[model samples]
Structures are given as C-alpha cells and as structure tokens.
Target: MTKRFLHITTLFVLMISVVLTGCGTEPAANDSGKLQVTATTGMIADLAQRVGGEHVEVSALMGPGIDPHLYKASQGDIQKLQQADIVLYNGLHLEGKMQEVFEQIGKQKPVVAVTDQFAESSLIASGVGGGTHDPHVWFDVKLWSGALDRIEAELIKNDAAHQADFEKNADAYREELAELDQYAREQLAQIPREGRVLVTAHDAFGYFGKAYDLEVVGLQGLSTDSEYGLKDVQNLVNLLVERKIKAVFVESSVPKKAIESVVKGAKAKGHDVKIGGELFSDAMGSAGTPEGTYPGMVRHNVDTIVKALK
Candidate 1:
C-alpha cells in the first residue's frame, strides 16, 4: 500500500511539471503558418512586411503620424511584444522611452534593431561627447538598404524554412531603393546650390543632408526631449534672413508651432519665409497613400524641397 501511494504522488508531480513547462514554452506559428513579427514603428513594420513577404505577419506598435521620440509602450503594445515571435525596432535611442520595455522583451525572444548594421564611423554624432548617435538613419536610401540585408538574416534565423522567400523579396526591394535614390538625386539637383538650405522642426535630417548635399537646420536638437527657447527661434530667424532662405518645412510628427514661430520671427525681421510643406520626419504618412510608403516619402520630400527652393 505504501509503495502504491508513492508511485501515485510521483505521477501527479510529473504531470504538473509538464503543464508548467508547456505554459512557459514559446508559441508556434499562427493559423496562417507565418512567422509573427512586431515592429516598433510603421517604417520598420513596412520594411519587415515587405522583406518577410508571404512567410511572415507584421504589425506596427506605433502607426502613422506617431512621434517615436515621445512614444511610450502601452499595455496593448506590451501584450503584442510578449506574443510576437520576433520584434524589430529602430535602435540608437530612436524609441527613447521604450528602451526598458524593449530590454525586458528581449529576454523572451529576438528583439533586433534594423539600424544596428551601421558602423560608428557611418553614424552622425550628437551631444556633448558625441557618445550618442542620430537614430534617423532611414533618410539615407543607401544606408537604409543595409537594413534590408540585416532584416533578411533575422527572418531567416527565426524561420529557416522561408529563407528563400525572404532573400527574393529583399533583392527586389533593394532594386526599388536604388531607383528611389536616383530619383531623389535628379529632383534635388534641380535646386540651385545656394537655395539648398533645409530648415525643419527638428534635427531629423542629418542623414538626408549628408546624402544629398543640403544644409539642414533644425529648431531643436536630435532628440525632441530638449527644450527650445526664444533665443533658438531668434537665431534661426536671423539665419533665414541672412541666407535669404525662401522656405521652411514643418514635420508630420512634430508640432507645427515651432516652425510657425520661426516663420513669424523671420517676417518680423522683414524677411518673408514661407512654410514649404509638411515633410514626413520621425514618422511616415498615412497608410494606403503614396506618401505612406518609404520610396514615396523620399520622393515627396525631394519634390517639395526642390519646388520650394528652386
């Protein structure tokens, strides 16, 4: 009787252990048998979806017009990250507030940065010691293409079964990016060198300026976390007047008031500077629109800048 009781207890314990282990295990692919991917921003989501193709399901935590600088992870975002088979984000502190959440999620699964391929020498320096990097590497078409390769490798790492599909999709997208780069050069070349000054709400255009040979001025620093004072506005106004800049741009993600203030300040100094157009910075345009796609966004910006400054 004693031996039989011991055997029953051992069986019960083994069953409980199995249940707990199953609960902790990662989930399999979804009903569609696609690798589930969650990206922190729409740009990353679009890239992942395009690269992953039919073998992956991708979604964005922050959607159109959302500013990643100030965005924080919500409960829904947390839940999505927890359930995702893989997570991709734009690193270099672009998602400033969500770092801790991302780190926590990384413990469970792969949390990859699309921009991690950029070498330190390739990054734009920011801040006191230049210890930090500007996270807006997407503005440079050539630089962003590198991310395609990285994303492909990651997808393959997670779902080796779909390696062929990911590679094919990435190759096709790379060709499209090359064409977009050429288009931007042609459009921007139309603007006179003297008129190639790009003034925007913040310092999100360093990569764009470097790649296209434009001088970029932002009202605020690289990260929008810093405050902008009247002195800063006055300084930019003086620059616009001195340089005879015709147009300044407002960003879709940043508040327009800062750019508007600069315009007002310039006008007060007897220089009429017009608001060129709203540019997609930090965030892409609404989905289903031409501006919503990466290629479309770059073309729209180039056209807007050329038409305004030419």
Candidate 2:
C-alpha cells in the first residue's frame, strides 16, 4: 500500500511538471504576419511604420521625450531585440552607451543605421577631438527625407514580397515630408533676419538652423549627456550679451536649469530673456500631439522658433 501511494504521488508530480512545461513551451501570443519591427526612438519607429505599413508591427524602444543619447536597455528590451525581424536605430552614436551593444548585434541581425546615409560634411564636430558625429539628423526635414530613401532601400531588401507596398507607402510619406519641408521654409518667413536666432538647451539643432538660415545657440554642446564646463557657460553668456537674443529655449529631454541660468545671465546684463518654449530635441511628443510625428514635430519646431524669434 505504501509503495502504491508513493508511485501515485510521483506520477502526479510528473504530470504537473509536464503541464507547466507545456505552458512554458507555448509559442509567442502574437499570431500576426506583421513584422516584429523595433526602432531605437519614436522618430525611427514612425518612419519605419510609414515605410513598412500594415505588414510590420512597429514599436519604439525609447518612447516620446526619452533621451536616446543615454538610453539603456533592460531584460525585456533584450528579448525584443532578439525577436525583432529588423532593428532600426538612428545610429550616429545617438544611443551613446548602447551603441556598442547594437554594433555587436548587427553581426547577427539586420540592424541598419539610418543616419549613416548622411554625408560626413553634414555632421557636426564632436568637440571631443578633431571629428564627432551629430546624431540629431532628424531635425532637418530634408536630411530626414534623404534618410527615408535609404530606409526604403533596406526595407525592400528585407521583405521583397511586400516591396511594392513598402514603396507605395514610402513614396507617399516622402511626399508628405517634402511638403512639410516646404511649409517650414514658408512659416520661417515670419521671423526677421536678426530675430531668426535660436537659443536652446543643447546644440542639437545645428542642422535645422543651418538649413533654415538661423543663428543657433545651444547652452550645452551636441550631446545632452555631455557635462557643461565653466568655460561653456561663460562663452554662452558672452555670446548672448553680444547677440542680444531674448528667447532662450529649453529642450524637453534636458534639465531646465542650464537654460534658466542663461536667462538669468542675460537679465543680469539688462537684456530681456525668456524661455521660448520647450522643443522636442531627443524625442517626439505623445502620439496624438503635434510633436508626436516627425513632420508634426518639425512643424511645431518651426512655429515655435518663428513665434519666439519674431
């Protein structure tokens, strides 16, 4: 009787273990034919979705207003990366700490750096040495439009079956981006020559300013993750005094203290200064907001710059 009871308990345990094992072995819940697309930031996700359309299940690793320059991944993120059919990142050292990880993963997966398509001359100096790459290539709609061509090319390479669909969606989005670019030029007409200056939390908008013909001054350098030195603050004070620029801007991702200091400095010098508006520097706004999408983000930026400068 004791032997029979022990045998019954062992069989019950085995059955429970098998049941648990089957539960664990259950396949991924999502049963869609959609591509498991992952992008480093919301901007890239939006672009990839526009190009990939309904065939892809697009997701952003970094949500709106999240800083890519210092973004780090979690265990869940690793699983997502591994599962992704295509892992798209801005890839101008934008992910900063995670750049090395993505570099390694690129060996196994299709990890395409969209920003690599930009010309070196178009990049800003790192200030670390003779050359540094600027990761904020999306600020300029023209530059972003150029990146889309590369994006389309790569998408076509990955999923050739949906080549026509991808091309169709990409072409339409590209046209919209072109139209947004034209709108930027038109809206920026609101600001006067001298008033076309943009003072911001960081130097992310160099491309945008250069393309739009504005004097772009950043309280900090290209990367927000970069520390500010005394010389940096002093230099900005001198420039602000000289330029007599009034509206200093703060970025949504960066701390406001630095720009606030500039505002205080300008005021101490008897110059009227104010926080222009928070700009979407590192990330986009919430999905439904004006800054949610790339074109809307650029449009918001143009409107803000013109409003502040004019």
Candidate 1 lDDT score relative to the true structure:
0.84
Local accuracy of candidate 2 as per-residue lDDT tens digits, 8-110: 4455444434443544533235678777778888889889988988888888888876877666565566666666777898877787656556655565568
TM agreement with the true structure for every prediction:
0.90, 0.87
lDDT of each: 0.84, 0.78
Clashing pairs in 1: none
TM-score for candidate 1, residues paired by index: 0.90
- What's the true lDDT of residue 3 in model 2? 62
Worst 10 residues of 1 by lDDT: 11-20
Pairing residues by index, what is the TM-score of model 2?
0.87
lDDT of 1 by residue, 118-195 (tens): 888888988746488889999999889888888899999989988888889999999999999988888898889899
- Model 2 superposed RMSD (Cα): 11.0
lDDT value, candidate 2, whole model: 0.78
Q: Report the number of the highest-lDDT candidate.
A: 1
